[model samples]
Target: MKRILVSFAVLTSLAGVALADTHGAIAYSPSTSAIGWSYAHANRGDAETVARRNCDSSANDCRIAIWFRNGCGAVAVGHRGGWGSGWGYDGREAQRQAIRSCRKQTGSCRVIRWQCSENE
Candidate 1:
């Protein structure tokens, strides 16, 4: 009986963790080199607000680059001021997409930021 109860309690705790929302966002300056990113918030609104606020600390024209929930997000930049944002189930996939998007506008694209939600 004790063993069974312990297993049940662990499962219940895992379920509650899985139900929680993990929000993330990235913000960038339109005409500057400023960028800001955030992750693991409770909701999308808070994530975006924090990202934008951080970016705005360095520049006046900051904008949201991307927002994600329960996944990975990436930012890529290239020569000639090209920029891109992507979201995916994993970090590699997200970086690939960001580079792909940036390549459309300019060459020599590379990932500048990448993070996975839930610490994955």
Candidate 2:
């Protein structure tokens, strides 16, 4: 009975850790040509804050593009004055989608950044 209780306690702790929400954020400033991203943060606010700070170092008027919990995000830039971003459960899929989104606005597009939260 004691061994069973110890096993249950360990499993419960593991479950709690697994359930904790992990966050990711991206920041960008089109005018200043700056982009920053962070993943696997403990909270949304921390993720955004860190991303914005990284952007602020290189650009002005930086803003959060997106935030995701237990997911992935990506940014893409096009050849002809276009940019796009997307989020999804898979990092590669998010990058592909972001490129696709940028291609919608311009002819050719390439991925700028791809990041995934730990949970994803």
Candidate 3:
């Protein structure tokens, strides 16, 4: 019974850790035609602020593409007018999805940024 109580306590602690919030953000700049990304922030605002700052450093007209909590985000641009973004639990999957989304809109697409929040 004592061992069971100890195990329960450990599990509860682990659960709390897993529940902690983590954030990721992606921003795009039209002036420089660049994308900036930030991840593993403790809050959504921090992640978005960092990403926007990074983008603004290189160019003007910066805008956030996405913000994710406990997940991943990605952005893609196409040869013509197609642009896409995706968010998911897996970083690679998010990137792939972003590219895929862009391709659906246009024939050519490439990934610009991919970021993931730490799961804990």
Best by lDDT: 1
Per-residue lDDT value at 4 in model 3: 100
Q: Rank the candidates by lDDT, best first.
A: 1, 3, 2
Question: Which stretch of 10 consecutive residues in model 2 shows the poorest summed lDDT?
Answer: 111-120
Q: What are the runs in model 3 whose C-alpha is more than 4 Å off?
A: 1-11
Task: Quantify all predictions' global Cα lDDT against the true fold.
Answer: 0.86, 0.83, 0.85
The residue ranges of model 2 lying beyond 4 angstroms of the native Cα positions read none
Per-residue accuracy of model 3 over 20-105 as CA lDDT, tens digit each: 99998999874566777788899999999988888857477789988899899888888886778888888888888889888988
- Total backbone clashes of model 3? 0
What is the lDDT, from 0 to 100, of the residue 78 in candidate 2?
Answer: 79
**Candidate 1 local lDDT, 1-120, one digit each (tens):** 999999999999999988998988888885886888888899999988988888857598888888889988888999888989898989999999999998988888989888766566
lDDT of candidate 3 vs native?
0.85
lDDT of 1: 0.86
TM-score of each: 0.83, 0.85, 0.80
lDDT, residue 108, candidate 3:
86
- Alpha-carbon error at 18 in model 2, in Å? 2.9
